[model samples]
Every structure is written in structure tokens, then in C-alpha cells.
Target chain A: MIEAEGIVHRYPGFSLSVSRLAVEPGEVLAVVGPSGAGKSTLLRLLGGLEAPQRGRVHRRGPAVYLDQTPYLLERSVLENAAFGLRLKGWPAQEARRRALGWLERVGLSGFADRPARALSGGERVRLALARALAVEPAALLLDEPTANLDPANVARIEALIRAERAAGRAVVLVTHNLFQARRLADRAVFLLEGRVVEAGPAPGFFQRPADPRTRAFLSGEMVW
Target chain B: MNEVLEITLRSLAVSSAATLIAAVFGLPLGLWLGARGAGRLARSLLYAGMGLPPVVVGLFFYFLFSRNGPLGGLGLLYTLPAVAVAESVLAFPLIAGFTMAGAASRAEGVRRLVKSLGGTETQAFLTLLAESRRVVVAALAAGFGAVISEVGAVTIVGGDIRHATRVLTTAVVLETRKGELERAAVLGLLLLGVTLVVSGLLVVFGEREAA
Candidate 1:
């Protein structure tokens, strides 16, 4: 489980505040907001990637945060996927075997020897996912994993997130896509102007939001 | 032809020695400075060092090794070691600065990724070096080129001693001074050939890494 209380993160031109947030094992929580609404910042805070100025975040263990853009080490795909395990002092043979299995799961078994940077956009995203999931972290923080990906790739990644949830990992996802929230999230937090305006089950939040701002955002009437 | 071979071998030995020493001293410093995050002033100082005139560096070493200079007791002046010391001094900054820039360019992203993957600081640093090996190799190539083709410092400190300290560049200068134009041209060709071979190998290695 991961929990953030009174979290406030400040940047040069933007500040994001989350009064409270929590994700339990085997549950998926989606943070939905417009651009500049601080969805990513909130995820970063919960993931322990950044410290909050005015609050605390509690996590059972390290959270693996995946950014929108994939960051692959300049190594072969197999090595890149196995990097997390290697960092934790896992044996090279075991790490490679598990990494290769993950690669196969991600449908890149044939390209395990290829340089990671040479991967296409969708393949890179899958590689990033494989790399993250291979670590079996306590929590997973994803920021727009489907952004810019084709429909098929988007569906594929969504299925992987579901798999992660089924594996009893807490998943905190930030996305602009409402349909994805309906599909993957057990609960949703609606944020506007860096503040949470609504929080409830996915069906209730999307179908019957309490805040007018949430309604405006859900209706696509909010200009930004 | 045998004399030419001897000179060529000596030149190769001196320059390669300089390059190896500089890399040993420079790569870690560069990686540390890059990983710790250098400020603008530090960066400017490194860049200045990179651009420092080689002749000036050579002259400084010359005085340092001269009989009356502080380090003169070793009697290393006008020797091959003297040339190597001067050349290494000239190459150090280029290697260090390029490595620093390369590491800094991707430090933020790579470090974050490594940290997310549960890598320790040391692991992250080693991974950063591995990722930036191409840039580091380019730095080495630049350093080697600067030293192997240089004449001023090596000539000033090595004294261009025949059959002892006469590297290709200094030999070319001596042959030119003696109006041995053909000999000078041949030495110049040998210098260019060495540079080409070294650079070609680095390029091929870099391509292999990329592939």
C-alpha cells in the first residue's frame, strides 16, 4: 500500500497539492486531470521520486514510476529489462532468464539481443513496461502509458496493468483518458487546478461527479 | 627506413602512454564531476582547460623539468618521459571535459531511471559511464589526436633528440628545417596514417555499440 497525506509539491511556475491519497494492494487508482493539473506531480510524490513540501507519503516498499516517454539504458534489450534485478544483486543468470521471460511476455523475445535504443515507439513502451514489471515492486506509478500509442498498443498496455493489479500490486495511474479510467481503475480521483475535486468509485465518479469542475472536465466543457 | 621505423615506434609509444595515463586520471574525475553536477563556473574552468594552448602547456612543463626548476632533480627534461608528461597534461582536459559533458547530457534521465530500478549511487554512476562510453571514447580519440600530432610541447620538453625523443611531429619539423622536404612529407604521411587508423577503430567500435 501507498499513502500520501497533505502532500504539497512546488515548482517554479506550478504547485500541486493532494490532501490525501491511498492505493491498496490489488487495487488500481487513477488520477485524471487536464494538462497542468499536476497529475504527474502527484504520482511522483506517491512514488517517492520527489519529496513533498508539507506532507508525508508512506509506502511498503519502493514504487516503480514509469514516465510517458520510455527511458532505456544504452544496452541490449535483455540487459535493460534485467537492470532492476541486477541492481538488487540478483544473480546474472537468473536475472537474464527472468528478463528473457518478460521479454517474451512483451513479445520482444526475438529482439532480446538488439540495442534498446533501436526499438520503435510502441516496442520501447512495451520494453519499459517489461522492465518495470520484472522488478515486482510494491507499487507501480504510471503517467500516461498509453499517450501517443496506437489503439492496439494501448489495449495491450491496459491488459498488462490489469495483470499487475491481479498480481496484488498497488497501481497509481495518471492519464487524460476517461475511457481508460473506466476500463482499468477501481477508483478515480478527479483533479482540477492542482486540487482534488472529486474522489469515488470509477463508475460513480465518471457517471455522477459531485464537483462542477469535475462535471465540466468530464463533459469536455472545460477549456483547459 | 629503420631510423624512420624507430621514430615511428617511439612516437606511438609516447602518445599512447600519454593517452592511457590521461584516461586513467581524467575519466573518473569527469564522471565524478558530471555525477555530482558541476556548476557553471566549474564547467567554464574545464572548458578553458580544454582550450588552453598546447605550446604554453609544453613550455610550462619545460621550465618545471629544467635543471634549476622545482622538479629538475629527477633529470627527466629533454627525455621521452618529459614529452609524455607534457602531452598528457595537454590531453587531460579534453578527455575530462568531453566525458563530463557526455555524462551530464544524460545524467538526469539515466540517474532517475537507475534510482527507480533500485540501483545504488555507485551502480548508477557505473551505468552512466557505460551508457556514455561512446562519448568517452570520442574524448580519448580527441585527446590522442591532440597529443600525437602536436609538435610544440613535445619539441620543447623532449628536445627533439635524434634516435631517442624524435616523434613524428618533431621529426617532421627537424627534416623540414634541414631542407629534407621528402623526408618531412613522409613523416607527415605516417602521422596522418596513425591518426586515421586509431580514429577508424574508434568509429567502428562506436558503430558496433550503437548497433
Candidate 2:
């Protein structure tokens, strides 16, 4: 489980405050908001990529974070996927074997030896997914994972997210897609102007938002 | 003719030695500054260092090693070692500056991803270096070019001693002054050739990186 309490992060002209946020095992928590509502910032804080000014972030197991545009190492695809295992002190051969397996899972086995920089946008996203899943992290924080992806890639990614959820990993997804939230999220939190305007089970939140801003956001109206 | 060969070899040896020393110190310094994101102050200092004149560096070391100067008892003045010291001073900043730029480029993304993947500080740094290796090669080529073609610094500190401290650049000056135009031309061509080889390597690396 990963949880944040009373988190307050400030920037030059903006601030994000989250009184409480939690992700339990096997739960898919979709964070939705308009652009600039601090979705990425919130993911960074949860992933330990950034620290909040005043808050306690607690996580019970290892976690991995993936940004919208995955940053692949400038090396062979297999090496990039095996990077986390190497960092964890796994033997090189064993790590490569497991990375190849993950690559196969993501349908990238043919490009194992190819340079990561040569990968196309969609392939790079899949490579990043393989890299993240090879380590089998207990928690995964994905920021705009399917944003700008083609529908085919989007469906593939959503299926992978469901598989991770089924395997009992906590998944926090940040997206602007209401349909995606309805399809994959067990719970949904609507963020408005850096504040959580509403949080509840995905169906109720999408069908009957308690907050006016959430209703407005869901109704195809920009809340900002 | 044999003297030209000797001078060319000595110049190569001296400059190569200087490049090795500069890389030893400069690479780590650059990496440190780069990993820290190289604030404006650091960038300014490095650029200023890059602009330092080779003659001034040579003169600085000349003062340090001259008999009447401090630590003169070491008797390093007018020697190959003294010339190398000046060359290293001239080359260090070029290597370090380029290295800093290369390592810092696209670093934030890699840093964040590495951290999230459980990489230790050292591992993360090594990853950054690996990612920036091509640029580092470019830095080395630039440093090598700066040191190898330098005449002012080696001339001032090396004293152009025949069969001992004489290098290609200083030899060219000597030949030109003594009306040995043919010899000077030869030496000059050799110098240009060396620069071209290094530059060619730089171009190839640049192309590879771009691809």
C-alpha cells in the first residue's frame, strides 16, 4: 500500500494540496483533471520523484513510475528493460533473461537488440512498460500513459494495466480520458485547480459526481 | 629530416600526455558539475576557463618552475614536463566544458527515471555518463585538438630545445625564423593533418549521435 497524507507542494505560481490519497493492492485509482490541474505533479510526489513541502508519504513495497513520454536509456532495448534488475543486483544473464521475457510479453522480442533510440513512439511506450513490469513492482504510478497514443496502442496499454491490477499490484493512473477511467479504474478522483473536488467508486463518480466541478468536468465542460 | 620525425613524435607524446592528465581530472569535475545541473556560476567559470590563453597558461607555469620563482628547486622549467603542464591547463577547460554540457543535457528525465527505478546515486551517475559517452568522446577530441596544435604555451615553457623539448609547433617557428621554409611547411602540414584527424573523428561521432 502507498498513502500520502496532508501533502502540500508549492511552485512559483501554484500549489497542490492533497489531504489524503491511498492506493491499496489490486486497486486501480484513476486521477482525472483538466490540463495544469497538477496530475503529473501529484504522480511525481507519489513516485518519490519529488517531495512535498508538508506531508507524509508512506509506501510498504517497491514501486516504479512512468512518465507520459517514457525516457529510454540510450542503449539496446534489452539493456534498458533490464536496467532495474541490474540495479537490484541481479546477475546480468538472469536479468537479461527476465527482461527478454518481459519484452516478449509486450511483443517486443524481435527488437531486443535494437537501440532504444530507434524505437518508434508506440514501441517506446511498450518498451517502457516492459521495463517497468520486468521488475514486478508492487506499485506503479503512470502519468498520462495513454495520452496521444493511437487507439490500438491505448487498448493494449489498458489491457496491460488490467493485467497488473489482476496480479495484485497497486496502479495509479492519471489521464484525461473519461471512457478510460470508466473502463479500467476501480476508483476515481477528480482534481480541480490542484484540489480533489470529488473521490468515489468509479461508476458512482462518473455517473453521479457529488461536486459541481466534477459534474462540469464530466459533462464535457472545462472546469478551469 | 630525422629531426622533424623526432620533433613530431615528441609533440605527439607531450600533447598526448597532457590530454591524458586533463581527462583524468577534468572528466570527473565535469561530471560532478553536470550531475548537479551546472548552475550559472559553474557554467560561467568553466567558459571563462575555456577562454584562457595558452600563452598565459604557459607563462604561469614558467613562473612556477623558473629557477628564480617559487619551487624552482624542482628544476622543471624549460622541460617537456613543464610544457605538458601548460598544455594540460589549456586543454582542461575544453574537455570539462563540453563534458558538462553533454552530461547535463536531458539529465533531469534520466535522473528521475533512474531514481524511481531504485538506482543509487553512484549507479545513476554512471548511467548518466554512459548516456553521454558520445558527447564525452567529442569533448576528448576537442581537448586533444586544443593541446596538440598549441604553439605559444609549448614554445614559452619548452624553450624549443633540440632533440629534447622541441615539438612540431616550436620546430615550425624555429624553421621559419631560420629561413627553412620547406621544413616549416612540412611541420605545418603535419600539424594540420593531426587537427583534421581529430576533427574528422568529431564529425563521425557527431553524425553517429545525430542518427
Candidate 3:
């Protein structure tokens, strides 16, 4: 479980203020917004990557945040995948075993010994996802996990996320792809200028957005 | 010929020891300052230290280790250890400052990534250091290069005692003063050759690891 209330983060000329947000286990909440809409900031705050100036983030257990451009260690693919496990104090052999399992799950088994920097874009994302999943966090906050990928990789990643939700982990996905949000989100929130514009059950949010701005955004007319 | 060889060997040993000592303390200090963004004042001081005059460093150490000065009881003055200590002092800022610059540029992303993985503060720092190993190596090279070619600090502290404290740089100075210009030039070339070989080896090693 993850929750934030009265959150406010500020930079030089912009501020993000979200009154309240929560995600329950076994649920996926998709945050949809235009560029500069603070979706990534919201994920960072939820994941404990950044502290909000005026709000508290409460997590029931560990949370992992995957950045839009994931930062992979300069190590072998297996080492990268096993990093979080090693941090959690797992024995090296056990961590490697578990990481290997994740690698196979993500279809990266053949590339385990390869240096992480040698991987392609899609492979890098898969490796990152595998690394995050290997840690088995209670909450996964993902920022644009599939910004640029082929349909097959997207399907694979979406399936992995669905599996996490099925296993009773809370997921907060930030995406610009409305179709992806509609497909995967149990509930959805529309944000604009760092404010929640509309939020509802995913089906209703897509079919009958209550706010005109949400409607404009859904129709691709809101460009910013 | 044997005397010249001994002097060259002593020079290498003193400078290598100095570089090692400087790196031992300097790398950690640089990593910390880089990871946690030093203040402007601290950064300014570090930059100034990097360019400190070797003669001034020599004078400072000479005073500290001289009779009636603080730490004089150790009897380190006019010894090889005294020369090594002086060189270490001269080299510390070069190692630390360059390492700081390198780490500062790359630490933030590594820190955030490590934190998101539920790693502790120490883990984050270690990971940052590992990721910036090349930077650390370059800093070590800079430190070694600075100390190996230095004559002022070693001369002041060691007194360049023949067959005892004389090193390549001081030997060159002594020979030149005695009008043995050919011998001085040979010693100078030997110093340059050592510097180039060590630097080249470090670069090659770094590249091999990268590959």
C-alpha cells in the first residue's frame, strides 16, 4: 500500500500539488497527463525518491521507482539484476539464483553475462524491469516504462506488471499512452498543470470524463 | 653508475609511497564531497590547494619536522620518510580535487537509483565510487605525476643527503650546480621517462578495464 496526502513539490517556476492519492494492494492506478503535467514527479514522491515540501508519503512496505531512462550499473547484466537483492543483504549465491530466475522471466537469460551497457533499448528496459521485480517491493512506481518500444516488448512488460498486481502488489504507472492506461489501469487519474483534473474508475474515466479539460485531454486536443 | 641507480630507485619508491598515501585519504574525502555537494567555500579552498606551490609545501613541512618545531620528536627531518610525507602533502589536493569534480558530475543519478533499490547510505556511496573507478584512477595518476617530478618539498625536508635522501630531482639539481650539465640532463630525462611510462600504463590499464 502507498498513500500521499497534501503533497506539494516546487521548483523555480513550477509547483506540483496533489491533495490526496492512494493505491491498494492488488490494484493498478494509472496517472495520465500531458508533458510537464508532473506525473513523473508524483511517482518520484510516492517512491520516496524525493520528499514533498508539505506532505507525507506512507508506504506499508518497500517501494521501487523505475525512472523513465533507467540507470543501469556499469556491470554485467546479471550483476545489475542482482543489485537490489544484494542491497537487501541476500547471500551472493542466492541473489544470483533469484536474479537468474527474473532474467529468464524477462527473456534475458542469454544476456546475463553481457555487460549491461551492451544491451539494446528494449533489452535495457527489460533488464531494468527484471531488476526491480527481483527486489519484490510492495509498491512499484514506474515512470514511462514503455515510452518507446515495439509492441511485443510492450506486451511482455504489461504482462509482467499485471502479474505483479495479481500477486497483490500496488502499482502506480505514469504514462502518456491513453490506450495503455485504459488497458491496464484499475482506476485512472487525469492531471493537468500539477492538479488532478478528473479521476474515476478506468472504464468510466475513459468513457465519460466528468471534466471538460479531461475530455479535451482524452480527445488529444490538450497539447502542452 | 650504482649510485645513480640507487638514487633513481629511491625516487620511485618515495613518490610511489607518497601517491599511495595521498590516495588512501584523498579518494574517500573526494567521494564524500562529491556525493554531498561541497559548499562554495570548501570548493574554493580545494581548488587553491590543488595549485599550491611545492616550495611553500616544502617550507611548511620543513618547519613542522625541524628541531624545536611541533612533531620534531619523531626525528623525521632529513629522512626519506620526511621526503615522502612532504610529497604526499603536495599530492593530496590534486587527487582529491580531480576526484571530487569527477564524482560530483556522476553521483546524483547513481545515488537516486541506489536509494530506489532500498540501499543504505553507505551502499549508495560505495556504488557511486565503483561507478566512478576510472575517475579515481585518473586522480591517482595526477597525484603520482605531481609528486614524482617535484624537487622543492623533498629537498627542503630530506636535505638531499647523498646516498641517503638524494632522489632523481635533487640529484639533477646537485649535478647541475656542480657544472655536470650532461649528467643533470640525463637525470632530467630519466624523471620524464618514468612519469610518461607510469602515466601510459595507467591509461592503458584503464582502457583495458573499460573494454
Candidate 4:
């Protein structure tokens, strides 16, 4: 379980101020907004990428954070996947053993020994997913995970996210693609600038966004 | 010429010695400054150090170890240790500056992700270095080039003592002063060739990184 209590993060010309936010253990929350809408900022704050100036981000059990930019190591795919687990004091052999399972889970079984630098864009995303999942995080936080991916990879990533939720982990994903969010999100949060103006079940929010910003967002109108 | 060859070989050993010392003390310092996000201040100090006249740097250390000075009793002046001191000074800034830029640019997002994963401070920094190994390797090349090309500091501090401090660059100068420009040119061109060789190696690494 993850709960964000009055989170506030300040950046030049913008800020993210969420009063209260929480996700059920097995829920999937989609954070949707246009560019500069603080979607990534909120994800970073929650993911411990950036510390919030006020309030707190509390998480139970282990968590993994994946950013839009895949920070792949200059090593083989197997090594990249095993980094976090190894840090947690898993022996090299055991870490590699677990990494193989996650890589296979993300459909990258054949790429275990491949250098991470050589992976394609979609393959890189898949590898990033594999790396994050290798820790078996109790919760997963991803920022624009599928933004640069093509349609085929997007479907695969969506499936991967859905599968994680089905396996009973909290998943928080940030995206600008309304269609993608509509497909994968169980609940939706509409962010305008840095504030969440609408939050509800995905279907209801897609059909009837309460705030003007949310409605404008759903209809492809520029609200920021 | 044979005597010069002996000096050359002798100097290569000394320079390698200096480079090893530099690798030990300076590499980790570079990694430290890089991981912590020291901005223009650190850069200015490094660039200023890089641009330091080798003779001036030698003079500074020379004064420190001279007979009446603080470390005079240690008798490190006019020795290979003196040369290594100056060489490391010259190499330190190069090692740190280039390494910092190289590592940070390559691992910008890794720090954030690693911190989020509950990694310790040391683990976060180490993760950046490991993630950007090619960049760190390039930094090592840059450091090597700076230390090896330098003639002024090592020559001055090491006193150009025959069989002790008469390195490639200093010997090249000695040969030139004696009107052996041909030999000087040979050494000069060899120095240039070494630079190119180092550059070629870096380019190979860069290409591999690009891949």
C-alpha cells in the first residue's frame, strides 16, 4: 500500500501539491496530463526520485520506480535486471537466477546475455520492466513508460502492467496518452498544471470528467 | 643517443609510476565530485588547475620541499617523488573534471532511480560509475594524456638529473638545447604519435559506447 500525505514539490515555474492520495494494494492508478502538467513530477516524488518539500510519501513493503528514460547500465541485460536485488544482498548467482525469471516474464528471455546498450527502443522498455520487476516490488511506479514505444511494444507494456495488477501489486503509471490510460487504468487522476482536479474510476472519468480541466483534457482541449 | 634511450626508458617507468599513483588517489576523487553535483565552482577549480603552467606547479611544490621548507627534512625534492607530486597535481584536475562530466552525463537518471530503490549513498555513487563505465574509461584516457604530455613540471621539480629525472619531454628539450633538433623532433613527433595513439584508443572506446 502507498499513501501520499499532502505532498508538495516545487520546481522553477511550477509545483506539485497533492492533498491526499492513496492506492489500494492491488489497484492500478493512471496519472494523466499534458506536457508540463506535473505528471512526471508527481511520479518522481512518489518514487523517491525527487524529495518533496512538504508532506510525506509512505509506502509499505518494497517498491520500484521506473522513469521515462531507462537508466540502463553498461552491462548485459542480465546484470541490469539484477542490480537492485544484488544491492539488497542477494548473492550474484541467486540474483542472476531471479533476473532470468523476470526477463522471461517480460518476454525478454532470449536477451539475457545481450548488452543492454544494444537493445532497441521497445526492447529497452521491456528490459527496464524486467529490471524493475526483478525486485518483485510490492508496488510499481512508472513515469511515461511507453511514451517512446511503438504500438506493438505499447500493447506489450500495457499487458505487463495489467499482469502486475492482476498479481496484486499497486501500480501507479503516468502518461500523456489518454487512449493508453483508458485501456490500462483502473482509476484515473486528471492533473492540470500541478494539481489533481479530478480523480475517479477510469470509465466514469473518461466519460464524465467533473472539472472543466478534466473535461477539456478528455476532449483533447488544451487546459494548461 | 643510447644514453637518451636509457633515460627515455627510465622516464617511462617514472611516468607510469606517476599514472598509477594518480589512478589511486584521483579517480575516486573525480567520482566523488561527480556524484555530488559540484557545479561551476568545481569546474573552475579543475579548469584552472588544468591550465596551470607546469613550471609554476613545479615551482610551488619545489618551494615546499626545498632545503629550508616544510618538507625539507623528508628530502623528497629533486627526486622522482617530486616529479610524481607535480604530475599528479597536473593529472588530478584532468581526471576529476573529465570523469565527472563523463560519468554524470551518462548516468543522469540512474541516481534518482537508485535513490528511490533505497540504495545507500555509496551504492548510488558506485552505480553511476558502473553504469557509465565507458565514460569513466574515457576520463582515464584524458588523465593519462595530461600527465604524460607534461614536460615543464616534472623537469623542473625532478631537476632533470641524469638517469633519474631526464624524461622524454625533458630529454627532448636537452637535445634541442644542444642543437640536436633532429633528435628533439623525433621525440616531439613521438610525443605527438603517443597522443594520437591515445586518441585512437579513446575513439575506439567511443565507438564501442556508441554501439
Candidate 5:
């Protein structure tokens, strides 16, 4: 389980305020909003990449945060995937073996020896996913996982997240695409101007958003 | 011819020795300066080192290591070791300064991301060094080149003692003055060939990596 309460982080002319949020094991929670709505910032707070000014996040299992910009290390693809595991004190041989397995899961097994910087954008996104999932974290947090990827890559990433959920891992995803929310989100949080204006089942919220702001967001009338 | 070959080998040894020592001292300094932006003092020092005249460095070492100087009691003056010492100091700034610039130009975000992944501090630093591998190579090459081509410092501190401190660069100058033009030409050609081969290899390595 991942729990965030009373989270408030200040930024220039903007703020991220999540009064209460939780993700149970095996459930997927997607935060959807327009650009600059602090969707990515919310995920960053949960993943421990950015600290909240006045709240605490309690994560039940190991947490790996993939930032909006993928930071692939300047190492072999395999080494890059195995990095976090090694940091967690796993032996090099075991970490690398598991990383290789995850690479295969992401359809990048054949290119394990390639330098990571040589990978294309889609390949990089997949590789990032493999690295994140290799740790077997109880929850997964993704920031704009498919934003820069093409349709094919987008489909593959969505499939990966779905698989992780199916395997009984919790997922917290941040995205602007309503189609993604409708397709994969078990529950959705509709954020408007740094506040969670609506939170409920994805079907009900997408079908009937509680807030006028959320309705405007869904209609493209409230694009930031 | 045999004598000249012997001197050339001796000189190459001097230059290589100088370069190796400089790398030992300079690589770490370069990595630090690169990882952290230089402060006012460090920035000035780096710029000065980049343009440091070999003669000045050589002259400074000579005075310090010579008789009546601070290190005079050690009697290292006029020895090959002292020449190597002077040359190493001459190259230290170049190797370290260029390396720092290389390390700093990349994103600080890489550093932040590495830390967030829970990597050890050592792993983080090694990661940064790996990213700047090419820049570090260039710094090392620059250091080696400067020491090999130098004349005044080695000539003054080394005292041009025949067959003892006669490295290639100083030897060429000495031989030319004594009307041994053929010997000097051969030595100069050899030095030119070495620099060309080294620089050519670096350029090729850089180009291939870039592509």
C-alpha cells in the first residue's frame, strides 16, 4: 500500500496539495489532469523524488520512481536495468540475471549488450519500465510513461502496467491522456489546479465527473 | 645513431613518467572540479593552469628543488627524477582542468536521479565519471602532449647533462646548436611522429564514438 496524507508542496505561482490519497495492493490509481495541473508533481511526491513541504508518504513495499524524463545511465543496457537492484544490496550476478529477465519481459532481450544511450526513444521507455519492475516493488509510480512514445510503444507500456497490476502489484500512474485513464485506471483522481476535485471509480468519474472543473477538463475547455 | 636512439628512448621514458604521475594526481582533482562547479578560486586556478607557460612551471620547480632552495637538501636537482617532477607539474592543470569542464556540462539531473535510485555515493561518482569518459581521455592526452613538447623547463632544471638528462626535446635543441643538424632533424621528426600518431588515434577514437 502507498499512503500520502496532507501533502502540500509549493512552487512558483503553483502548488501541489493532496489532502489524502491511498493505493491498495494490486489496484491501479491514475491521476489525470491537464498540463501544469501538478499531476506529475503528485507522482514525484509519492515516489520520493521530490519531498512534500508539509506531509509524509508511507510506502509499504519497495518503491521505484521513474521520472518524466528517463535517465538512462551511460552503461550497457543490462547494467542500467540492474542498477537499482545492485543498490539494494543484491549480488551483481543475481541482479544482472533478474534484470536480463525483465529486459526480455519488455521485449528488449536481444539488445542487452547495447549501450543505453544508443537506444531509441521507444526502446528507452521500455527499458525504463523493465528497470522499474525488476525490483518487484509492491507499488509502481510512472510519470508520463507514454507521452513521448509512438502508438506501438504506448500500447506496449500500457500492456506492461496492466500485467504488473494483474501480478498483484499496486500502481500509481500520472498521465494527461483520458483514453489511458478510461482503459487502465481502476480508480481515478481528477485534479484541477493542484487539488483533487474528484475521486472515485474510473467508470463513474469519466462518465460523470463531480466537479465542473473536471467536466471542463474532460471537454478540453480547461486546458492549462 | 645508437647514442641518439638511446637518448630518444630515455626522453620518451621521462615524458611518459611525467604523464603517469600527473594522471595520478590530476584525475581525482579533475573529477571533483567537474562534479562540483569550481568556486572563484578554483575557476581562476583552472584558467591559469590551462594557459600555464611550461617555462614558468619549470622555473618554479627549479628554484624550489635546487641547492639553497627549500628542497635543496634532498639533492634531487639536475636529476631525471627532478625533470619528471617539473614536467608533471606542468601537465597537472591541463589534465584536471579539461576534465572538470567535461564533467560539468552534463545535466545535474543525472546526479539527482542516481541518488534517488538509492545508489551509494561511490556509485554515483563512478557513474558521473563514466559519462565523462571521453573528456577525461582528452585531458590526459593534453597533459601528455604538453610535457613531451616542452623545452625551457626541462633544459633549465635538467641542466642538459649529456646522456644523463638529455630528453628528446632538449636534446634536439642542444644538438642543433652544436651543428649536429642531422641528429636534431631525426629527433625532431621522431617527436613529430609520436604527437601525430597519438593525436590521430584520439581523433579517430572520438569520431568513431561520436558516430
Candidate 6:
């Protein structure tokens, strides 16, 4: 479970304030917003990458945050995948074994020995996902995990997220793709200018947005 | 010829020792400064240290090890270790500053990734340092280059004592003073050759690691 209450984070000219938010086990909560709407900030807060100035984040078990442009270690792909496991004090052979299993699951078995920098864009994301999932976190916070991926890569990643949800991990997905939210989100929040404009079941939130701003954004009328 | 060989060996030993010592201290300092995003004042101080005059460092050590000086009781004023220590002081800033620049460039992303992967603070720092290994190697090379070719600090501290504290740069100076221009030129070339070989090895190692 992941929960946040009264999250108040501030920068020089911007602030993100959320009174309450929660994601239960086996749930996918999509945070949909335009650019600069604090989606990534909120995700970082929930993932404990950054502490909110005035709020509490309650996360059960471990939570991993995947950045939009994932940072891979300057090492072999196998080592990159095994990084988290190694950090948890797993023996080298055991970590590599578990990492290899994840690599096969992500369809990257053949590229295990290659340097991580040698991987292409989509392949890097898959490797990042493999690294994250290998740790078996209770919550996964993804920030634009598939921003510029091809359709096939998108499908593969979406399938992985679905599998994680089915396996009872809470997922907080921050995305610009409304279609993707509609496809995978059980509950959704529409954020505009750092405030949640509407929150409900994904279907109703997309189909019958409660606010005119939400309708405007949905219709592409709300320009940044 | 035997004297030349001995001088060359001694020079390599002293400079290598100094470079290693500088790296042992400098690399960690650089990594910490880089990880913390060193401020303008810290950067300015580092740059100044890198450009510090070698003779100034030599004088500082000379005074410290001189009789009636603070460490005078040790009687290390004209020893090989004194030369190495002086060279280390001269090389330290170069290694640390280059490492700081390299680590600063890549530390943030690596640190964030490590932290997000449930790593502790120490783990994140170690990961950052590991990721910047290439930079550290290059920094060591720079330190070695600076110390191997340095003459002023070794001369002041080691007193260039023949068959004892004499090294390539100091020997070059001694031969030139005796008007043995050919011998001085040969020693100079040997020093250059040593620097070139060490630097070449480091570059090849870096490239191999990249591959």
C-alpha cells in the first residue's frame, strides 16, 4: 500500500499540494496531467526519493521509482539488473541468477553480457523494468516509463505493469497518454497546474469528467 | 649507464608512490565534493591548489623537515621519502580536481538510481565512485604525470643526493649544471618516455573497460 496525506512540496516558483491520496494492493492509480503538473514530483514523493515539506508518505514494504530516462550503471546489462539485489546483500551468484530470470522474462536474455550503454532506447527501458521487478517491491512508481517507445515496446511494458498489478503490487503510473490511463488504470486523477481537478474510477473519470477543465484537457482544448 | 638506470628506477618509484598516496586521499575527497555538488568557493580553492607553484610546496616541506622545524626530530629533511611527500602535496590537487569534475558530471543520476533501488547512503556513494572509475584512472594518470616531471619540490626536499635521493628530473638538473648537456637531454627524454608510457597504458585500460 502507498498513501500520502497533506503533501506540500515547494520550489522557488511552484508548489504541489495534495490533501490525500492512497493506492491499495493490486491497484493501478494513474496520475494524468499536462507538462509541469507535478505528476513526477508526486511520484517521487511517494517513492521516497524526495520528502514532502509538509506531509507523510506511508509505504508498505519497498517501493521503486523508475525515472523517465532511466539511469543504467556503467556495467554489463546483467550487473545492472543485479544491482538492487546486490544492494540487499544477496550473494553475487544468487543475484546474477535472479537477474537472469528477470532478463528472460523481459525477453533480454541474449543481451545479458553486453555493456548497458550498448542497449537501444526501448531495450534500456526493458532492462530498467527487469531491474525494478527483480527486487519484488510492494509498490512501483513509474514516471513516463514509455514516453517515446514504439507500439510493440509499449504493449510489452503495459503487459508487465498488468502482471505486477495482478500479482498484488500497487502501481502509481504518471503518464501523459490518456489512452494508456484508460487502458490500465483502475482509478485515475486529472491534475492541472499542480492540483487534482477530478478523481474517480478510470472509466467514469474519462467518460464523464466532473470539471470543465478536465473536459477541456480531454478534448485537447487546454493548451499548456 | 648504471647510474642512469638507477636514477630512472628511483624516479619511477618515488613518483609512483607519491601518485598512489595522492590518489588514495584525493579520490575520496573528490567523490565527496562531487556528490555534494561543491560550491563556488570549494571549486575555486581546488583550482588554485591545482595551479599552486611546486617550489612553494617544496619550501613548505623543507621548512617542516628542516632542523629546529616542527618535524625536525625525525631527521627526514634530505630523504627520498621527503621528496615523495613533497611531490604528493604537489600532485594531490590535480588528481582531486579532475576527479571532482568527472564525478560531478555523472554522480547525480547514478546516486538517484542507486537510492531508488533501495540502497543505503553508503551504497549510493560507493556506486557513484564505481561508476566513475574511468575518471579516477584518468585522475591518477594526471597525478603521475605531474609528479614524474616535477623537479622543484624533489630538489628542495631530497637535496638531490646522488645514489640516494637522485631521480630523473633532479639528475637532469645536476647533469646540466655540470655541462653534460647530452646526459641531461637523455634523462629528459627518458622522463618524457615514462610519462608517455604510463599515460598510454591508462588510456588503453580505459578503452578496454569501455569495450
- Top lDDT prediction, candidate number: 6
Best by the TM-score measure:
6
Q: Candidate 4, residues A15-111: lDDT per residue as tens digits?
A: 8899988777778899988888888788877777677999998988877888787878777899888878888889999999999999999888898
Across B1-211, the per-residue lDDT of candidate 1 in tens digits comes to 5998999889889999999899998899888788889889888988999888888988899899999999999999999988898899888999999999899887877877887776777888888888888998899899999999999899899989998898999999999999999999999999999998988887788657652
DockQ of 6: 0.64
Highest DockQ against the true fold, candidate? 6
Model 4 is docked with a DockQ of 0.46
How does model 3 score on DockQ? Answer: 0.55
Per-prediction DockQ, in order?
0.58, 0.55, 0.55, 0.46, 0.34, 0.64
Docking quality band of candidate 3, CAPRI definitions: medium
- Tens-digit lDDT track of model 5 for B1-211: 5877777777778888998898888878888877777788997897797787878877898899988899999998889999999999988888888887887775365665565575656776877777777887788779878988899899889988987898889889988999999989999999887766766776677545431
- lDDT (tens digit, per residue) of candidate 6 on B84-168: 8889988899999989999998888888788888898899888888888899888989999999999888999999999999999
Give one clash count per candidate, in the order shown: 0, 0, 0, 0, 0, 0
Please give the CA lDDT of all the candidate structures: 0.88, 0.87, 0.91, 0.80, 0.84, 0.91
Candidate 2 residues lying further than 4 Å off, grouped into runs, are B196-211
Candidate 1 is graded, for docking, as medium
From the highest lDDT down, the ranking of the candidates is 6, 3, 1, 2, 5, 4
RMSD of each: 1.9, 2.4, 2.6, 2.9, 3.5, 1.8
TM, every model: 0.95, 0.94, 0.91, 0.91, 0.86, 0.96
Error of 6 at A193 (Å): 2.8
lDDT of 2 by residue, A1-224 (tens): 88999999999988899999999999999999999889999998998888789998998887889979988988889998998898889999999999999999888999998999999887899899899888888999998888888998898889889988999999999998889989999999988778998999988999999888888889997636
Candidate 3: the clashing residue pairs are none
Model 3 misplaced regions, further than 4 Å: A150-152, B68-73, B177-189, B196-211
- Model 2's chain B yields a TM-score of 0.90
Clashing pairs in 6: none
RMSD to the native, candidate 5?
Answer: 3.5
By summed lDDT, which 10 consecutive residues of candidate 4 chain B come out lowest?
A: B202-211
